[model samples]
Target: MALFGFIGAGNMGLPLMKAAAATFGKNEVIFTDASKERSQFVSDQTGIRFLTDNCSVVKQCKNLVLAVKPQFFPVVLNEIKDVVTKDQIVISIAAGIKIESIKSMLSNSVRIVRAMPNTPAMVLQGMSGICFSEDTFTDEEKEIIDRFFKSFGKYEVFDERLMNAVVCANGSSPAYVYMFIEALADSVVSYGIPRDKAYELAAQTVLGSAALVLETGEHPGKLKDQVCSPGGTTIAAVKALEEYGFRNAIMKATDACYKKCEELSNK
Candidate 1:
């Protein structure tokens, strides 16, 4: 059997196909996309193979990754449910699709992993969160899937209830971070820095700051304090950010994102 099979080869799916190929080799990976040209593009880019249809992928592969967008899950699940076997592991990277919802379409006997992965995965720095249908996977199966995710970036397994929180935290937060970088670069440009240099400086600062948090395991507050010395420019900037309600704005944004995830789950 092929090691990894993808149901769609769009932006997120394409990178994941590459990661699976990196982990298991190209010959063991296969996929199918809605557009034949898209499927062919992925094949040419990664040297992976593609079949003509989703059920063909289900028949051939052991671990099936349903990488289609959330709206298409119902149709795609209906198409493959009949052909998917109990021995196959079906993993989904679509945001806001619940395990119970999938179990209703496919049988409870079918193994399902619901996951959310961000766009940074295109550059191999993606973070993913997963939740399994109860008692559905062996420890060995879990290990291989974990390795598959780590081939692109890091991953964490969470309780299914917290999966929406994962949506707001990492899955959608990159857009906010990118907006912050753009605003910071604009401010730098207003201060006479070249626009290209300003963007590079702002983006690198954000990247390094995130790296510090991940690498040091120190509280972000402590790191911020380190930068804001007594009567320093950093402290002055911090005071301005607080005055503008930066933290509150982020909290509100996350709350909205969480509510939207809940809405998607219900639909």
Candidate 2:
């Protein structure tokens, strides 16, 4: 039996399986997807066993990750609820799905951990927010969950009530960041730089800027001030961004994301 099993092989599932394969041997990881072709592809690429059905994955693995979409949770959980044992630990990556909801789907005695991880996890630089049900997981079980999350990137354990906020801050912010990079590259390309070179420069600048923030632990506003001197080009561009409502746009976008998460959780 594989040590870990993933019930979906889509975008989030693929990356998560890859992360788990890093900690457990590839052969120790098993997965199943609704699409046989998708499952086979992941199996071929990662050398992990691909079970033909979701129940097989649940039965064969001790640690099960419910990597299916939020909408499909009901169907998938119904399929495995009969076989899932109290001894197994189930981790869910479906956004907005709470621990209580999962417990209701299966059995209240089942150990459940909810996690929100972003697309950056594909590159092993993901930020994850994880929360576990009260009085359910032992210290060793919690350690196992932490190790699984950290295998891909950093994780913070917080109250599940803050999960919607985490979704806006990290889960959905990657798309906003990508849009910013695209706009930056487009602006440079308009100035006669090659498109590819513009993208490379823009992306690297964002990467280095983020690294600076993490490494120096300095306020981003102070860093901006460091680059902006009196009568400077950086300040001029900053003023233009302010006039264009750049900051307000980001604020509104994240707010929209948070609200959407709340709506889903309510459903």
> Top model by lDDT, which number?
1
Residues 93-153, candidate 1, lDDT per residue (tens digit)?
Answer: 8888899899889988888988998889888999999888885577889888888999889
Q: In model 2, which regions exceed 4 Å deviation?
A: none
The per-prediction tally of clashing pairs is 0, 0
The Cα error of candidate 2 at residue 16, in Å, is 1.1
Residue-wise C-alpha lDDT for candidate 2, range 1-267, written one tens digit per residue:
777999998888899899999886797799999999998888888888898999989999989999888899999999999999999989898888888889898999898888899899999999999888775677877777778899888999889999888888888899999999999999989999999999999999999999999999999999999999999999999999999999999999988988888878878
Name the Cα RMSD for model 1.
Answer: 1.1
Regions of model 1 farther than 4 Å from truth: none
TM-scores for candidates 1 onward, in order: 0.97, 0.97
**Could you tell me which 10 consecutive residues in candidate 1 have the lowest summed lDDT?**
131-140
TM-score, candidate 2, is 0.97
